[model samples]
Target: MSFVRPDIIRPPSEHASYYLPLTSGCSNNSCAFCAFSFTTLGIRDLDDVKREIDAMSLYAKSRMWMAGQPDIVYAILRQWDGKRVFLQDGDALVYPYPRLMEALQYLNAKFPALERIASYATPQDILRRSVQELRDLKKQKLGILYMGVESGDDDVLKKIRKNVSHDQMVEAAKKVKASGILLSVTVILGLGGVAGSEKHALETARILTEMDPDYAGALTLTLIPETELYREWESGRFEMITPFDSLRELKTMVEHSTFSNCFFSSMHASNYFSIRGSMPKDKGKILRQLQALLSRRDPNMLRPEFMRGL
Candidate 1:
């Protein structure tokens, strides 16, 4: 099948970067809570990827268009600032290592000014590579990797079908940091639902401290209609906590997680309330902020349900 370009879903920081697709869908697609579980992974041909880079180069140099390429390629290129490139689909690092290297080389050849290249990487994908292989990619300007840790509780991990264990994820984080790449991970608030909410938050905080990520984000669980998690909720097997409870989970995580200067945030659209701070430095202030919100228990201060997104 021909590669279908995925919609531009990226980290908020990648707003100025080009979206490059090395693969479509995720290699680890068994997660019960993920939308990628519904799609099959597709790896784009190396030559096809090179052609897109070539097209980008042509447009950067002469504002020319390339034939036989999807219009979205040019659309992203037009908005690109030439400073960063974010490889797309769910986990582009799962792309074949040699082919990925070649593609990055081709991209660098075409755009030498690019400061960084990033991708969503699954723990399984990172663990598949040797320390040196990851270092090589980092040398190619692949400076950052966004990993979805989801939850730290082993039971929660098992329930969500994350496949990778807590220890394995910690190993993956160690590998990324060893490779000198900035590792950013996200944990879902209230992922353990009502029965396991507190344990989920505490365990997640433990894992975050263990992972010691350069950046950590907290996302509130938003049930996607067709997903298995959503079905579980509909069938009453999964009981979601209230909005305030979600914030409480976030507060618990923020209060317990220790970091080596990590930038922690709950600023994702899926979050009930947004708070971000540099860990260990702004910890006191951030905790006080969460305490103030939880103390008042005001729904008016939280993000509206209709405004939230996955």
Candidate 2:
């Protein structure tokens, strides 16, 4: 079957990036809370990827539009600055290493002035590659990777079917850092629900400290309809924390997680409130902001459920 290009679902930091796809859906798609659960992974043919690149190059150099190229290509190219390219579809890093290398090589050859390339990578994918392999990709200008740590609490991770252990994620982070690639990881704020919330927050903080990522983000859990977690909530088997409770988890994480100058934030659209700053140095200030909001307990001040998006 021909590959189907997945819709753009990317990290917020990749807003300025040109969306490139080598794969669609996620290789590890069993996470209970994820929208990609049960979706089949699709690998685009190398020639198809090259065709898109060829179209991009032609458009970039001559302002000529290709007849058969997908409109999304030109739609993105119109806004692209031609500096950064973010490989798309959940975890594009899961693309086969040799093909991925060739694609990046072709990308560089076509856009020699490209500043950096990035992709979301599952811990499993990151672990599959050696540090030397990752370094080789870095040499090709693969600058950063966005990893979803989800939750550090083992029980929470197990319940969510995240598949990877906390230790494994830490090791993956280490490998990425060792490869001289900037590591940016995200943890879910309300992942443990009411029952294991505190432990989840503490363990997540511990994991973040161990990883010491260049960037850390906190996203509040937003249940999607048809997802296992959503069904659990509907059946009264799982309990979601309130918005304020999520803020409390955010507070706990910020207070406990030590960082060597990590840029940390709860600025994701799923969050009720946003706080961003350089960790360690800005920890106190961030805590104060959370405290002020938590103390108020004003429902009006928090992002309403109707306004929240995945």
Identify the candidate with maximal lDDT. Answer: 2
Candidate 2, residue 24: the lDDT equals 92
lDDT of 2 by residue, 123-156 (tens): 9999999999999999999999999999889999
RMSD to the true structure for each prediction, in A, is 0.8, 0.9
Q: Native-vs-model 2 lDDT?
A: 0.94
Cα lDDT listed for each candidate: 0.93, 0.94
**Model 1 error, position 112 (Å):** 1.1
* Deviation (Å) of 192 in candidate 2: 0.5
Q: List the candidate 2 regions with Cα displacement exceeding 4 Å.
A: none
lDDT digits (tens) for residues 136-221 of candidate 1: 99999999999999999999999999999999999999999999999999999889999999999999999999999999999988
